[model samples]
Target: MDVKTKMRPQILLFGDSITEQSFRSGGWGAALADTYSRKADVIVRGYGGYNTRWALFLLHHIFAMDNRSAPVATTIFFGANDAALPGRNSERQNVPVEEYRDNLKKIVQHLQAISPTMIIALITPPPIDEKGRMEFARSLYGENTMKLPERTNEAAGVYAKQCIELAKDMGINSIDLWSKMQETDGWQKTFLSDGLHLTPEGNAVVHKEVVRVFSEAGLSAEDMPYDFPHHSIIDGKNPEKAFRVQCS
Candidate 1:
C-alpha cells in the first residue's frame, strides 16, 4: 500500500438500507466523510434490506479476522427491516426481539476480536410512521394488496430499547436515534422522507449526533490532523514535500 493509504485510519459504517443511503446527498455518512475528510476514511458497508441474521452470515466476509488494518471506529446500525410485523410481506426480514439483541451483542464481539481497541458505536433503529409507511406500501403494491406497513413505531421502539440496553451492558457508545428524532412535534413529517427513511433534515440530525459522540469520546476533529497540509499552507513550488512529511 502507498504511504498515504497506509497512514490514514478508517471509520466503518455497517448496516442495512439506512446505511446504504447514508452517503446520498445531504446524508449523515456523507457529512462524516466531509467532517473527517483528511483525518480518516469513512468506509461504508451497507446491505440494503438486510437484517441482523443475514448480516451475521456476511460479517466474517466484510470484517475479515486476518485483516490487520482495523478501522478506528465502527457503527453498527440495524433493526429497521428486522422490526417488520409478523405474517407481513416483510416478515422475511423480521427477527425476534431477543434474537435481535443477541445478534447485536455477537456483532460487537466479532468486531472486538478483530480490533480490541477499536471504538464501537451502536445505533438503534429510528421511529416508523405506520400510516405513511403503509401509504408508501400501497403505492407500490396497490391499495387492495397492501393492508398495513410491515414495520411499526411500537415494534421499532422495542428493538431500539434492546439495542441501547445492550450497548450499555457492553460499555459501548450508543446513539438513540429512535428517541432523538421524535423529541420534536411532527417528527414524522420533518425528519422522515418515507416512514422509515431519513429526510435531508433527518440526515443532519444524525450527523450532528455522530459528531457529538465522537467528540465525547475525545476524537474531536481538532484533535485529529488533516491527511496532509492544507493548500494554503503547502509550498506551492514543492507540494510533494508537504505530502511526504505529512503522510510519512
Candidate 2:
C-alpha cells in the first residue's frame, strides 16, 4: 500500500456463527457499521459453527501481525458452540470450560502482540433455552429430534462465567450476553431466534452494549474524525481545494 493512500482505521468483529450472522438485516454488525460510518471500517471475520479451539487456526491468518493497517479494535465472541452438551449431536463442538478460557487468552495475547494498543473485547455466549432448541430441532427432524437438547442454559452459564473471569484476569473488556439477555423477561424468545442465535432485538442489545463500552474506552464515534472532509465543508465551485489540503 502507498504511504500517501488513506485507509480508514478498522474494527474487527471475530467469532462463531453469531458473529457470522451479525450482518443480516437488522444485525448488530450492520448497526456498528452505520455507527462508525466515515470514521472507521467494520470488518467481519466470523466463521459459522466455529469454536475457540477451531478459531485458533485462523487467528494469525486473519490478523497478520505485519499488516501496517491493523484494526483499532476487535470483538471476540465465541463459546456458544463450545458450551454444547457432551453426548449430544453437537457434542463435537463441546470444549472443556478451562480450555475455552485458555484459548481466549491466547487469542487476546496474539492480538496484543499484533497491536498492543488495539482494544479487545470479549463477549460471552448467549444463554441457551432447551425448549427452544428442542422445538427448532423438532421442526427439522420431527419425532426424530434428539431426545435431549444439545445445549443448556446451565452449561452455557458455566462457559460464560469462565469468559467473564478470563476477561477480568486479562484486563480487557467483556460483555456478559448470557446474563444481560436473561435480565429481560421472556428473553428466550425476545432476544434469541432459535435458542442460540440472536433475534433482531438481541442484536440491538449487543449493539447498545458494544457502543457503551467503546464510548467509555474513548472510542466514541463522536470523538473520531472523519476520513475525509465533510460534504458541508467542501467548496462546490472548487471541490479539489478541499480534498487537496487533506491529500497533501
Candidate 3:
C-alpha cells in the first residue's frame, strides 16, 4: 500500500436508493456506518432514483460543498436506477456505456485534483433482480401486482463487470461487493426481495461483505450480530434458486 493511501478517508458515500436509507433504514449504508464509525466519518449522499448522469451531477454538487482538506475516502455505488427500465417516471436507462464511464472519470479527476492523496474508491454497482425479484413479487402480490419489464440478469452482470474494469483502468481503489456478496452463504438466496432493491436481511448480507472491504482497506469495525429484514417485493427461498448467485 502506498504511504499516501494510508491517510484516513472522509468516506463520502454516493449512490442510488439502496445507499440512501434511514440511519436505521436497515440498509448496507447504515450497517457500514455502524461498523466504521470509530474509524472514519461516513457521510451519506445518496438519492433514490438517481442514475449515472444524476450521480455525476451530484459529484459536482458535492464538489461545491467539499474542497481540499475536506475528506479522503470516497466510494460511489451508482447505476441501479441508471439501468432501470424506461417507464412512467423512469427515463433513466442504458445511459451510454461510454458516457457512464466518462461520468465516473470526471468524478475521479475532480477528486484527484482537490485531494491528491484522497483514497477515492469506486465500487461496482450491486446486483439487481437476477433471480426474478419481479416475477416473485407478482406471485406474492397476485393481480395487485404491476408487471415490470423483466430485467435480464445478463445486463446487470455485464454492466457491473464493465464498471469494475473501468475503475481499475482509471486507478481508483475499488471494492467489488457484487463478487463478495455472491460468495457469502445464504446471501444471494435473499439478495433481492425486490426487483431493484434489497430487504433488510439482504442488506445485512451486503453489509458484512462491504465491511470486509473496508477492513481490508485498513478501516476497522466492531462486530455486530446479523439482522435481516426480509422484503417481499421479490420473494424466493429455494436454495436451488439461491445457487445462481454466481458473479462473473
Candidate 4:
C-alpha cells in the first residue's frame, strides 16, 4: 500500500441502500468526508436492498479479521428491507424481527472481535409513509400495482425498537432515525423521498446525528490530528523541512 494511504486511519460506513447512496449530492457520507477531511478516511460499504441476514455472509470478506489496521469507527444501518410485509412482492427481503435482532448482535460481535477498541454505531431504519409508497409504486409499476404498501411505519418502528434495545444491551451507540424523524411535523414529506428512502433534508438529519454521537465518543474531527502538516507550515525555501517532520 502507498505510504499516504497506509498513514491515514479509516472510518467505515456499512449498511443497505441508504448507505450506498450516502455519497449523493447531499449525502450524509459526503458530509462526514468533508468534516473529517484530513483527519481520517471514510470508507463506504453499502449493498442496496440487503437485509441483516445476507449481511452476515459478507462480514468475513469485507472486514477480514487479519487486517492490521481496522477501522476506528463503523456505522451499521439496516432493517428497512427486512421490515417488508410478508405477503408483498418484496416479501423475499423480509426477515423476522427476532432474527433481525440476533443478526445485528452477530454483526456487532464480529466487528468487536476484529477491533475491540473500534466504535460501532447502529442506525435504526427510518419510518415509512404508506401513501408515499403507494404513489411511488404506481409511478413505477402503474396504477395496477399492489393495492397495499409493502412496508409500514409501524412495522419499521418494531424493528427500530429492537435495534435500539440491542444497542443498549451491547453497550454501543445507536441512532433512532425511525423515532427521530417522526418527532418532526410532516417528516413523511420532508425526510423521505420515497416512503422508504431518504431525501436530502433527511440526509442532513443523519449527518448531524452521526457527528453528534461521534463527538460524544471523542471522535470529533476538530480534535483529530491531520495526517500531514498544514500547507502554511511548509517553508517555500525548504519545503522538505515540513514533510520530513513526523505526521501530525
Give the top-scoring candidate (lDDT).
4
User: Model 2, poorest ten-residue lDDT window?
Assistant: 1-10
lDDT of 1 by residue, 137-241 (tens): 778878686676688899999999999999999999999999999997999979988799999998898899888888788678778987668889778898888
Error of 3 at 17 (Å): 0.4
lDDT of each: 0.90, 0.92, 0.63, 0.94
Count: clashes, candidate 3: 5
How many steric clashes between backbone atoms does each model show?
0, 0, 5, 0
- Candidate 2: deviation at residue 52, Å? 0.5
Q: Which ten residues in a row have the lowest lDDT in candidate 1?
A: 1-10
Residues 1-248, candidate 4, lDDT per residue (tens digit)? 65766777789999999999999999999999999998999999999999999999999888999887789999999999999999997999999999999999999999999999898999999999999999899999998988988999999999999999999999999999999999999999999998888999999999999999998988999998878889999999998889887643
Clashing pairs in 2: none
Ranking by lDDT: 4, 2, 1, 3
On a 0 to 1 TM-score scale, where does candidate 3 land against the true structure?
0.71
On a 0 to 1 TM-score scale, where does candidate 2 land against the true structure? Answer: 0.96
Using alpha carbons, what is the TM-score of model 4? Answer: 0.96
Q: What are the models' TM-scores?
A: 0.95, 0.96, 0.71, 0.96
| Overall local distance difference test of candidate 1 | 0.90
The whole-model C-alpha lDDT of candidate 3 against the native structure comes to 0.63
Candidate 3 backbone collisions, by pair:
9-73, 10-72, 193-234, 201-228, 201-229
